[model samples]
Target: MGNSLAAIGARHQMWESTSDRLSSSSDSCGGPVVSFGQALRSAMETRDDPESLGTSSQDLADVDEQDVADSSRKSSVSAETAEKLCTIPREKGLDAQDFRCAMCRKTIGGSTFSKFETCAIDSKYYCTECMKSGGKVSIPARVVMDWDWRERAVSDRGRAWYEANQEKALINIKTTNSRLYAHAPALEETRKLREKLQLVSMYLFTCRESVSEDFRRRLWPKEYLRSEIDVYSFADLIDVKSGALQRRLNSLLKHSINHVMTCTLCKQKGFCCELCTVNEVIYPFNTESTHRCLVCFSAFHVECWRTSGDCPKCVRRQNFETRRAQVDDPHNTLLVLQP
Candidate 1:
């Protein structure tokens, strides 16, 4: 295993345990969660500084000196406590933490479109911030296996190309087969082309060598069909595994006999009120909100207007407009009117 896998070596085990806690059904985030370093950092951000807590500048200076003196690392925090900070519902508003980033702990309810990102390997929530800055993405066994098969296929193609061109190569024509005489310019062209192909072939082979076999089959099922591409593509619609009550409502209650599903957002299967939602996944026609976003054109529940922030798509548009105004400042280059 590489250093990146060693980093999550501990937490990945806890994430797998979510299956045991799946049926908790407590009207909140249901299941185990990830590391809580982000949540702890958020708590510290909200705390008042010592200056506002009735402490003098001189006294604060003394306390700060003391804290610096005792800066040695304490005993390691319990792994159990660290994991607990990742899951929540202790308070009413905390249900939002279900969609919190596994790394930064940024919660989702801040906007209509959830900022929470899903891990392709374990199906856990990782925010976009963590993915970009944090480092190499770690995959569980299942996904790594998929990559392995692809690598093999690429290698086979490269080998076949070499076999077809080996006899026609300029070197072979010059020494072995004197009948096929080529002038200097033509030989140069053929040599350059072969070198380029060889470089590309070696580059792909190196990539396969760097990856380990440990991450083969993680979250995806054992029996999924591997298509010409991943037989399972991004646009492919999957049928939901229906529950008894949902079936009853469809048949006996004369409702639109359909399905209720749990989408694997960021890989983990849960409700995060983002691109994948109860209404968006299970019932497309019965939208939660009637008002469609001006940017994405997706409907958001009317209650979005009352929230502290706007929809994610609209927020993106506003940010773009603001940036344009700043960058195109009229005074930056004086435009004298050509009267």
Candidate 2:
């Protein structure tokens, strides 16, 4: 009876183990096997509607475009602001129409246009012509007595007289050795006479001395003598009556200095050395002293030719000669046979 009871107990244990295995298999098989991709797809499909998704993307794109447009508008506004900041304001009370001559009532245009400034003391605007006329208008005391009085005083009539006298004076100085040829004295005296006559002419013509030092420099450089004349020696006897010295001095100053050729090799701008012409490296067989290539008519320096060997385009023509000479040569044929 004990043995039978033991066997029954073993059978009961086996039945419990089978029941657990069946429960585990049923649990695993009961639910559908969903893959990671399918689960993600289902989640996404449930969470978002197709129309809503498209609307979201469109909204984001619109926002991005709006941001870009806003940035562009800001850049344009900044550019405009920079331009406005950099622009210079026009002078007050002065317009394009106000630039005309007040006395002659002629439109001042191009190079003849006169620039005017209001006198600080007088508080009146004066054109170059009106100022030169020496009318009752008040002018700066400094401007009237400036060093450029000779140029400021010259008139149309005075200019003609000066030109004629200047020519005479130059001739007289050149032909005869006189005290007038003594350099400073002659030049200064001529300038003084010209200045006096110019002042008189200015009063008679334009009435003011509006011509500046710059205008004088451009128009009459001879009227102002700043340096000592180098054309005459003190030992030379000069006639004070004849204006020979002045003419000689003017001629000497006006003479042009001789310019020499530049070297292509040394890159020197002034005169080239005679020795440099024979230099093989500097003046190559194919290159000229003027920096021109003899073969192709192109230009290059000695240094550039050294690195490139020969003219880039012309060197190809030498290949046929090289091949012909090499093929015909006995030494090349021997070397080819030995190799």
Candidate 3:
């Protein structure tokens, strides 16, 4: 009987082991029968109980949702921080809304604020520190080389010298008929120079005089003028004058005409003498030889006098012989001297 009992116990233990294996496999694969290791691994992978795996389905879901929320929060925070940096005023020791620093009374950095510091005592936009430290920045007025005419004017002694000697800086005019026509050559050239000077001078004067309270009150103020003038501005002016003078001189040298052509007999190109006119002496005068007018220095054809009513060369010349005869003896004396 004892031996029979021992055999029955052994059979029961084998059956129990088989049952445990089947239960584990069914839980892992949702099916019957699997390898022990595979069943254990699968059970671990799909385990949902918090007590066994140190986590639950609800807890994992909560962690994933929390991660997404944290990432979104970080992105939003970064965007807000960037916007704040962009909006912040760059000026030291000043708030965004304030134009002046409360502690230092200096101008704050902002689009709407003036760059200059203000003094409380003088009610002026100039700081004591800046004034004390200045070599030239403290000066009320600035000298710009490009627009120095007015600055020179302000310094009257300098202006007077410039005004008196400005013409010497100009280019001279050239002409072929230097003897007969006095005004045409120099006057024309000087007129052109004067025009150019006037234009440049006007521009300079306007710029110099533009600094005013009324002008500054506008939407956009002019740039601050530095005290020292640059050498380049004066150099540019000189260069312009030199170039113009050189070009004109070159043109005059290359294209100048030396002489003029004119009529020979009766000393006129038009209104021939009564003797020549009545005789029909059209071919009596030479047209080939070049002759310049003594009075006007113009050139004309000698044969042109046959039909011309007046002297072509001497358009403004008076018939003083007729006038003088009228003054001297009325008219008979002129006829006697006519031959």
Candidate 4:
């Protein structure tokens, strides 16, 4: 009996030590903790009456159900509060909600709740602890919109997500937020010039001119070439805002245009404005003077296209089709000579 009692005491001491550790961990995580005494009392009550086990189980079920309901209610309320906070005007500031770390959802900012750092992306507040714990990151939104390369404080998880997706062509300023154009009109012009450069690069790609090498190197990176004009990575956007990208595009465009106009091999790819009698070579990149036919893809002078309202190549193709059809018919005995 003494040995059995000693064993029970040892087990009780071990359980107490484990419970103390558990209590400390739970407190750190802001989770509920049931003390060793309460747990022991509950177990004793259930053991005292064999019939009371079912009642105790039912009570636990009730408590679990109540906890679930409360958790759901809190989640819904948090979602609604976040939505309202997003709707609030930025100029007015978010003084309504108590300052808390956006990353850990921890209560921070001391007594006044005014000491905090803002995330560069959404301007959300974060605590110094969160910032020290891997919160510094470059926001992709600011990189794409403003070409900001400076890192700012964010949640650790948020920083991880951004670093993982930094290379992706995810942000499309044209489709997502076009108001940036209204704010910075020069940016719109830059995009337009880039589009034109994209077209010009097509002509330069097949040409044997020495400038083609320069064009390939300077006419945007290969990854960026796959994306539309509005889509860009942080590195490319930074280069653009720094004026290096624009300078390269201008130099390449000028050289490639000169090569296309002068080189015989390059001119073979050019189109003559058939809509008019002008013998000058025309290309699609010459947007000011040339108009490309939508149906036949033939180039023509913009003024000639405006007057005729038809493509000369398209008209010739239609006439040839008509003659071929007539010749194919047995009813028409005339032999049509193909041009």
RMSD of each: 32.3, 39.0, 50.3, 33.0
- Two-way TM-score contest, 2 vs 4, winner: 4
Question: Candidate 3 — which residues are off by over 4 angstroms?
Answer: 1-240, 258-339
Instruction: Give the per-residue lDDT of model 3 (tens digit) for 1-339.
Output: 465546545654654454343211122222232222232233334333475446666876677777889989987865543332122123233343255543345675556654544322222333334433322211111111111123111122222323343332121111212221133333334334433322112112222234222222321221110111111122223333346543543332222111001212111112122212232221111224222233332323344344464543233224433343444463433233322
Distance from true location, Cα of 300 in model 3, Å: 18
TM-scores for every candidate against the unseen true structure: 0.17, 0.13, 0.16, 0.52
Residue 54 lDDT, candidate 4, scale 0-100: 49
lDDT of 4 by residue, 1-339 (tens): 466546645755655454333311122212332222223234344435646434555665667777889989987865553332222214224454355567767666667653566655456666766666665765556544454558766656556655654554444667655776665555565676676665565555555546556665655354354226776544455556577667766776687678766865555555556556665555767777877665544667789889988765456556555755654466764433345
Instruction: Please give the CA lDDT of all the candidate structures.
Output: 0.31, 0.34, 0.31, 0.56
lDDT at position 22, candidate 3: 29
Residue 224, candidate 1: how far off, in angstroms?
A: 32
Best by TM-score: 4
Angstrom error of the Cα, residue 50, model 2: value is 99
What lDDT score goes with residue 331 in model 2? 68
Candidate 2 residue-wise lDDT at 83: 33
